[model samples]
Target: MYVPVSLLFFFIGTALFVYYKTQPGLLPETVTGDQVFPYFIVNGLPAGFTGLLIAAIFAAGMSTVSTSINSSATVVLTDFFNVTSHSEADEKRKMNILHATSVILGALGVGVGLAMMSVKSALDAWWSMAAIFSGGMLGLFFLGYIARGIKGSYAFVGVICGVLLIAWMSLSRQTVFHNYLTIVLGTLVIFTVGMLLAIAGSRLKKGN
Candidate 1:
């Protein structure tokens, strides 16, 4: 259900996007790929519908931003400040700290968003960054699920290799792999390397 729904959603979206992009005079040459959809929504749609869509977009954005800020604040307080170890009376102090952290993080998030406005394509930039950063975690996930008898040290080595591969793929113009494939390749690399090392280790142990 989920897969089919997602496929349908993307299929329809891509088709409409392509139509809009290829249709001449609908969008100016100066309008970027990222700006095209919003521009269309505002200009093409009826007034009431346009307002509703804009409101929906704002609601989604606000929800996501709030969640991120809250999560970040929780991490900062729990991990760095050790707020959880505080006394019951200090709950007020913790609340104050959390509020302050959330405000600071939210401000930082706004700054980053403003900075990213200059980027050509927000979607492309996001995917590239996601691919680069997801490598280590995705590799670890694969190792945990697929690579039997693999020790943490060997897994760490595999993750390092995977991260390097992903980084090179993302940063180097010479790399053949696409940005979308980075996490896939990185996870496979980590799992494969870790499994091979584990097998070799076991073989050596048996021989010894």
Candidate 2:
């Protein structure tokens, strides 16, 4: 558990940051942490850890851009076009919607990167934010797909709790390595709320 968690920080954490930098308006500023920290503190290394970090960052940024573009394309084709299901709109309308969505997603990504400037530590901020944002998606999967007849309301509530707790932690200045608190808090909220919603949704379904 400990090793895996540590790896997540060293790997996933670094990757997320690199992704952020790749976005427009979020490029690196002066000689900050990334520039200051040597690959190996004790001894210099060639083609070393800094190289690895740079590679990881590019991979992350490229991956995000690729996936977001793909998802947007799929959504336009399937949802707006109703391609396989049905094509309600004409080609022009569908094309317009796809373009609009692409612009929106790009704008939103820039906004998120800008917002991240206020975060105290890069790793801590990323982990905590990821936990808070992803909990609801995870809850939706558990409630809608994995569990039978789970209520959407319960999932919403769980997400709310997760946000509140994370926000409180953010304000309180509680710092722990590996961001264990955020993960534990987020998972607990998601699991509890999902279970409750599943129970309630089941009861409601049975009653009606």
Enumerate residue pairs that collide in model 2: none
Residues 99-166 of candidate 2: C-alpha lDDT, one tens digit per residue:
77778888887898898777656666766666665645654565566665555677778778767765
Instruction: Locate the minimum summed-lDDT window of 10 residues in model 1.
Output: 82-91
Kindly list the per-residue Cα lDDT of model 1 for residues 71-98, writing each as its tens digit.
Answer: 9898987887885565553788889989
Candidate maximizing lDDT: 1
> Candidate 1: deviation at residue 108, Å?
3.3
**Candidate 2 deviant stretches above 4 angstroms:** 1-32, 37-63, 76-87, 117-120, 136-156, 167-179, 194-208
Q: State how far residue 118 of model 2 sits from its true place (Å).
A: 5.1
Report every candidate's CA lDDT: 0.81, 0.65
Worst 10 residues of 2 by lDDT: 35-44
All-Cα superposition RMSD per candidate: 3.7, 9.1
Candidate 1's clash total is 0
